[model samples]
Target chain A: MAAAEAAFELPPPTAEEEQWRYGPINDFEIESYEPSVASPGPIQVPTEGPSGAAALEAASAVVTVADGWVVNIEVSADAAALGLTIQAGLNEPRTGFGEDADRFDRLHEAFAPPTLCISMRDGAELETPVVIRSHHTGQGRACFPHAVVETGEDAGLDVVEYQTSTSGKGFAAPVVQLSAGAASRLRYVVVQELGEGIVQLGRILCNVGSQATATAAMAAFGGSYARVRTDTRLVGRGATGNLIAIYYADQNQVHDFRTYQHHDAPDTQSDLMFKGAADDNAGSIYTGLIHIHPDGRGSNAHQTNRNIKLSDAAWAWSVPNLEIENNEVRCSHASTVSPIDLDQQFYLHSRGVPPAVADRLIVSGFFGEVVDRFPGVGIQDEIRRLVAEKLDRRGANQ
Target chain B: MTELVITDLSVSVGGNEILRGVSLTVRSGEVHALMGPNGSGKSTLSHVLLGKPGYEVTGGSVSLDGVDVLTMPTWERAKAGLFLGMQYPTEVPGVSLLDMLGASFAASGIDASGLSDRLSEEAERIGFGQKFLSRPLNVDLSGGEMKRNETLQLGVLKPKIAILDELDSGLDVDALRLVSRRVEAATEEDGLGVLVITHYNRLLTELHPDRVHVLADGRIVAEGGAEMAEKLEETGYAEYASAKPAATAESRFASGGFDA
Candidate 1:
C-alpha cells in the first residue's frame, strides 16, 4: 500500500494485507473519530487508572502523557546529576519511515501531539528506571503518542512505559523508537492495559549497535482489539537483542502481536519469546519472523511463540517463520497453539490440588517462563497480579 | 487406625482384564511388599488405586476407612489419604516444588503456614539442597532426583496409605538408601501404612515389610513373611513363572501391559 498524500487522509488497513490478516482491521474506521487537537488541562494522577504511578516507588523520572499531550514531567536530582534529559518534542527532523511505513504509522506521524525524547549521556549508569505513563481517554476520539529513547555509547539505562486509558471507548496509535549505542545496555518495558472498548495499534522499533545488549518486554492485558508490531534490528557486530511478551485476552477481546528480528551484521544474535492465553470468547494471534541477512554470517537467532486456549470457544494462532540468506548462520523457530497439557494437570491433581486451582497454577506457570525473564521489579509484580486477576475473572464467569 | 481394603478388585484395559481377582488389606503403621515379574500386574494395581484414567474397574470395591474410593477423582482420593508414588513423575515447568507442596497441603485441609521452613528441614534431613525446593517440580531433574523428589512429597503429605511403584528403578546405591530411610522415618513418625511395589527385593532390604505377597499372572500365587522375600532373592521369579498357568486372554493382554 502506498502512503497517502496526507496522514489524516490515509485509508484504514485492510484485512487482505499479510500484516493485518487475522486482525480486526475490517471493523476499524479512521474517519469516524476526531483527532486530539487541544490539551486536556492540568495533570492530576488518577488513582483508579490501570498501571498507575503508585506502583513505581523508585523511579528516577515520571512523565504522564494524556490524550496525546504531555501533561506533567518530574525528574529527580539523581537523574539530573547523571545527565539524563527528557524533552517534550523531537530535537531533530522526523523522516518518514520509507516504504514499509503503513497507513497507521503515517496517521501517527501527522497528528501525534509531539515526540517525547529521552536521552542518556555517555558512560551514565542510572540505578533507577524512568517511568512514562501514556494515557488515552475520551469517547469517539483518536490519539497518537510517540516517544524516542536514545542512549549514548557505553551508557546504561532502564525505562518502563505504561499505556492505559480512562474512557470506555477510544482509538490510540503509540509509537516508540529505541536506539542503543555501542557497548551500551538498555532495558525497556511496556505494559498495556487499555479499556475493553478501546482499540490500540502500537509499534516499537529498536536498533542495537556494536556489542550492545537491548531487551524489550511487553505485557498486554487490555483493549477490545489491541495489536503491537515490534521490529528489532541488530546492525553491528556481536550485538544481542531479546524480545519478550505475555498477553491474555478474555470476554470478546482480541490481542494480536507481530515481531521481526533482523540480523544484519555478522555474529549478531536475537531471541524472541512470546506467550499468551485466551479464555471465554476471546482470541489471540502471534506471527513472528527471524530474518538473517547475507552479511549476518555466524549469527544465531531463535523465535518461539506459545499459546493456551482455556475454553472451547477461545481461539489462538501461532505462526513463527525464519528467513536465512547466510549459509553460516544458525536459526530456529517454534510455535504451539494448544490447550493445557493433561499430564501437567494430572500431576497437580495427583498432588491433591483441586481442579480450579490446578488450572490457575498451570496457566500462571505457563506465563511464568516469560514473566521471570522481564527486567523491572515493580512491573513484574504488576504483571503477575494482572495475570491472576484474569484467571479469577475466568473462574467467576464459569 | 486407618485401613485400606481392596476386595476382589478386577481391572481391565481395552477390553482385556489385567487384575482378575486381587485382594489386599493394609493397615496403618504396617508395610506390605508386592513383588512380581516384569509381565505381572504390579504397576496396574497402583495406578488403578490412584484412579489414573484409561484403566476401567470391571468389578471391585476399594474403601479407605469405609468410604468407597473408586468413585472419587484422583485429587479426591489424595485428599482422602491415598497416595501413589509414580514411577515417572511428570515435569511441571515454572511451578516451584514449594508451591506444589503448599497447595497440596491446603487442598488436603492441612495448615500451609511455615511450609517453606518445613520443606527446608525435610531437604536437610534427606541431604537434598534447599534450592531444589524453590526449583520447578521435577523439571530438568535427573531420574534419581525425580524419585527422591517423590519421596520428599511422600514424607510431607503423610498419607494414610502409599503405594510406591518402582521406587528403586533409577536410584543409585546412596540415593536408594537415602530415599528408603526417609520412608522408614515417615512411617515411624506418622504411623504411615505403605505398600512397596518392585521387581527386586533390594528396596525391601532397607525398608523392611511385615508381610510379602508374590503376584504371578494377576493372582497372588504365594504369600508369606520376610522369609518369602529372602527365598525370592535367592531363586528369583523364574520358579513362579514356570508354575504360572497357561496364557489366557487376560494373561496374553498382560504381556503388553501399560509400561509408562
Candidate 2:
C-alpha cells in the first residue's frame, strides 16, 4: 500500500506539453474535487452481465469496482492455476509511472483508491479471460480507480474492465497499465457507460516487449464529458500492437479521445482504428499520433479515424499526426467525418423501413464493425445492447 | 380494366422542363415499350410517375386504376401499386436483400412472416442463388444481379403497375432472357401492367410488347404496334428526331391531350 501512495505523489503535467493539448484541465481541478476516503460500500455488480459482458469476460481477467473500492475480482481459475498473482502495490518509479509520465498520471494520482495489480506467471497460457467491472452509485459522489497488469516470459492474458454508474451524478477516473514480457500476448477491453451527469477520464498505457503482441478494444457510450487516452510503446523487436475504439454520443454530450503509438524498437508494427457517431448537438474529437525513433528500423504503423454525424447540429473533428525520425519506416493516417449518406437512407426507406428505424440500423451497423472485434461475445452483445438502449432512450426523449 | 393513366403531364426540375406534355395509358395485362434516345425524357417520366423529389409536376394527372397518384408522396405512390425500377438503384449498406424484400412485402399489405423464404424460392426460379438473400441491398452487386433483384421485389410486392427503366442496360443474353421471362410472368400470371423503357429492340424480341411509343425531345413523337420498336431500333431515333420540330407544342388540350 505504501508503493500505491508513492505512485500518487508523482509530478503533475504542465499545460505546454503536446499531449495535454485539447484536454480539459480546468474541469479536473483536484483542488475543487472533494477527496473522500476509500470505503467498503455496498457493491452492486450486474450478475446477469450487461449485454456484452459475457463475451468480454471470456477474453480477459474480470474485476468489479463499485463506488471507490474493489467489490469483485475474478481471475480465471486457469490463470490462477497457472500461477497468476493479484498484488495490490508494486510501486516502482518508471518512465510511465513517475511525475510527468503523461497526461494520464493526473487521473492515476488523483484516483488512487481501489488500485489493482495483476501478474502473469512465466509461460502460462490461460485460455479464459479476466473481467473487471467498475460501478458508481449515488448522486454527486466520485470514484477514482487504477488497474495494472504485467505478463512474464511467454505468458498470455486477456483482461476486460467495465465502468458503469447507477443513477445520481456519478464520476469516475480510471487508469490502466499493461506490461508485456518477451513473447507474451495480451488482449484488453475497456467499456464505459456512466450516467448522463457523470464525467469520466480513462487512460491506458501498454509496453510491448520482444516478440510480444497486444490488442486493445475500447467502447465509450455514456457520460456528459468522457475523455479517453491510450498510449502504446513498442520497446523490443518483433512487437505488434493493435488498438481499436468505438463511441456513440447523443444529446449534447461530448467525447474526446487521444492515442499515441510509439515505436522504439526495430521490426515493430502498430495499427489503430477509431470510429464515432454523434447525433443531436453532440460532439466528438479524435487526435492520434504515431512516433518512430531513429533506432526503430523496419517499423510500420497505420491510423484511421472515421465519424458519422447523424444530425445537422452534430459535429466531429479528427487529427492524425506522424513523426518519423527513422527512414526505414512505413506510416500512414486517414480520417473522414461526414453526415449519413442520403442515398443509403433512401435505399432503406424505399424498402419500407421507417426513417428512424433505418437510421438506427445504419448507425448500429456502423458501430458493429468495431464492437465485433472485441475478444468476447458477451462484451460484444453488451455493447450492442447498450447502443440499442441509448438509441431507444434518445428516441423517446426526442 | 386496371390501368395507369397519364394525362397531359409536364414535369420539370429546377424550373427547366424535362417531361413536357406527355400522355400515355398502360392497361393491365399489356406491356408498353417506350423507346427513346439518351436524354429523351423516358427516365424523367418514370421519376415523375414515381413522385421522386426534385421533379415538380408543373401540370399533369397520373392515376392508377382511377386513383389519382400525382399528389401522392413517393412511398404512397409505391403503396398505390406503382413500382419504378430505378435506372440506378442506390446501395444500402448492411441491409440484406431478403430483409428489404420482406419489409416491402409487409408494407404493401402482404401477410406472411416467411417472406424471405418465399422470395428465395422465387429467386431460385429465376436462376438466382439463395445466398443472394444475405447480400447487402444492391451494394457491390453486378448490374445483372441488381436487375434480377428488382424482379424479385416485383415478384414479392406484386404491384399493379411496374415501370422498368433501362432494365436491359448492362445484361448478357442469359440475364436478358431471364429478365424478359420474369416480366412475361408478371403480366401473364398477375395481369400486371408494365412500362418498359429502353433504347433497344432486343428485349422486346424476347418479351413482345403490346404497344410501342417513340420518345424524342421530351415527347412521344410516334406510337404504333410492336413493329415500331424494330423500326426505331433500326433507324436509331433519327427519323423521330427529324420529324418533330424542336419547340412545337405537339398538342393543345384543356385537360387530356399530350399538352399541359
Candidate 3:
C-alpha cells in the first residue's frame, strides 16, 4: 500500500449487529485514524536467530515489523538447510475460506499491507520455532499488517506472533492466513500486550488438510478493547483443528473473542477451549461455534469456555453454538462464568495461605488444564507471572 | 497460664447456635480426646478455632498464653501455633503438594531452608511415599491416603497445638498405627498439645489420651480419664446427657466474652 489507492469501502460494524454484540463496535471509526508513518531501517543479516528482550532463544528465524512496515528478516543456516522460504505478498483465500464474510476483512483488504509468506518443504521437521514480532508506535496512527503461511505434505512447523505497542494511542488490525498440507503438523501462538491506549482487531483463517493437525493458541492481556476472530476448517478426512486461548481484562478493559470450527469432511475432528479472567470493572465476551456439514458424518467436535470474575463489578458473557446436519457426528459444548470458589478459599486459608496469594494460585491453576494439553511452545511461566502481577495489583487497590 | 484455653466458647453458623457455653483447656504436651457424636458441635468447635468462614464466634474467648486467638486472622492464628487437620480436605487442582506446603510455611513464618528434607522425613514417618508431594493437592487419592496426607501436613507444620478432627475415620489399622506413632512423638519431643476429636474408642485406645471429654447438647457433659471414653463407647453419649442440663441462654449469647 505504498501508493495509497482511493476507493469506495463498506461501513464498519456496529454493536447493533449480532456478530459485534458485547464489544465496542460503535467506537471503531476507520475514517478518523491516520496511516502509519514508520521509516524503514537498514536490514541486518545474522548467523544466529533473534535474541533480545522478549525474544525466544530457540527460534530458527525472526521477522520484525514496526508500525505496519517490515523492518528485518533473519533465517539461520539450519532453517536454510531445511528448505524454508520467506517472502512478502498478498495471499489468495484457500479452499472453503471466504474473503467477503465480515467488515473486519473488508477493512483488512482496503488498508492492510502486502502480507509476509512463510513456507516449508515436505518432511521438514525443524525443532525450533519461527518468531515474529509486531510493534506499534506513534499516536492516532493505525497499523494493518498481514501474514500468509503454508506447509508441504508431512512437514512440521511452529510459529509465534507476539504483538506489543511501545507508547502510543492508535488502532491495529492484523490478519493471518495458514494452510497445512496433508499429514503435516503445525502450532501457532499469538500474544498481545499492547499499551493502554490501543484498540486491536485481529483475524485468522486456518485450514487443515487430510490426516494433518493444526493447533492455535492465543493469550491476550492488554489494549482498551481487543477483539479477535478465528475460523478453522477441517477440509480433509482425519484432519484435526484445535483452538485454545487464555486471556485477562483488568480495570475497565474489554476483550472479545469469536471462533468458528467447520468440519467439512468425514471422520474429521475439532476441539476448542478458551479460558479467561476479568478483574475490577472489566468485561469479557466469548462466542464460538462447531459446524458439521452433511459430508462430515462420523466427525467429532467439542467446545468449552470458562471465565472467572475476580471482582464483584467484573462481568463476562459466554455463548457456545452448534450446527450439525449429520446425525452420525458427535458434538458437545459447555460454558461457565463465575467468581472464585468460596470452598477453595476456605481450604487455602485454613492451611495458612493468605487470601491474595490463594487467589493468584487459583487463577493460574484454572488455565493449567489447557496449558497441559498444548505443550512445546514454552510460555507457562510467563502466563503465571503476568497473572500474579494482575492479582497483586488488584489486591493492592482493594 | 501455660494452657491453650477456651473459656465459655459459644459459636453459631448461619445464625444456628452450634456450640453453647463450651469451655475446655489443655496444657502443653497433653493428649486430650474430645468425643462427641455426629453433629454434637465437635466440628464446629474446630472450625471456630481455625476461623473458617460462616462460623460466627458470637461469645467466646480462645487464647494461647494471653495471645487472643479470636481477634486474629486465620493466618496470624496459625503463625501463633494453632493447626487444624480437617476431616475432608478440599482438592486444589493445579497447586501441587510441595507448593501448598511451602506457602503454608511462609505464611506461618517458619524457617523454610530445610523444607525438602523435612518433607521427606515427615512422609517417612507417616508411611507415605515422597512422590505424593509432586502431585496436585488431595486430587485422586484413596481415602486412607488422604487421611495420611493430612497427618503428614500436621507433622510438617509442627505447630505447638494441633486439633485433629476425625483423623482415624478413613485410616486402616496400619495407617492408624503410623499416625499414632507420629502424634505420640510430636507430643513427647516437641511439647505439642493434642486435641483429638473422634466418636470411636479405637483411636483413643491407640493414643492413650491423658483426658477424655464427652460433648453433648453443645457443652461438655462428662470429663474423666481414658475409662470415660470406654464407658461412653459401650453406652453411647445418650447415657451422659441426663447428668447435666444444657447450657443456659444467657451464657450462650453473652456479648463481652468475644474480646472484640
Best by lDDT: 1
lDDT of 2 at B126: 73
Name the candidate, 1 or 3, with the larger lDDT value.
1
lDDT of each: 0.85, 0.77, 0.80
> What TM-score does candidate 2 reach?
0.88
- Per-candidate clashes, comma-separated: 0, 25, 0
Of the candidates shown, which would achieve the greatest DockQ relative to the real structure?
1
Ranking by lDDT: 1, 3, 2
DockQ of 2: 0.38
lDDT per residue, candidate 3, B1-260, as tens digits?
Answer: 25789988888888878787788888789999999777778998988888887888878798988788998878777767788888888788788767777888887677778888888889998889878877787888877788888888888787889999998988999889999889989898888899999989999878879998888757776778999889888898776554452344555444332211
Task: Return the top candidate by TM-score.
Answer: 1
> Isolated chain A: TM-score per model?
0.96, 0.88, 0.92
Model 2 chain A poorest ten-residue lDDT run: A92-101
Tell me how candidate 1 scores on lDDT.
0.85
Off by over 4 Å in 2: A1-32, A48-61, A90-104, A326-330, B105-112, B242-260
DockQ for each numbered candidate:
0.67, 0.38, 0.58
How well does candidate 1 score on lDDT at residue A250? 95
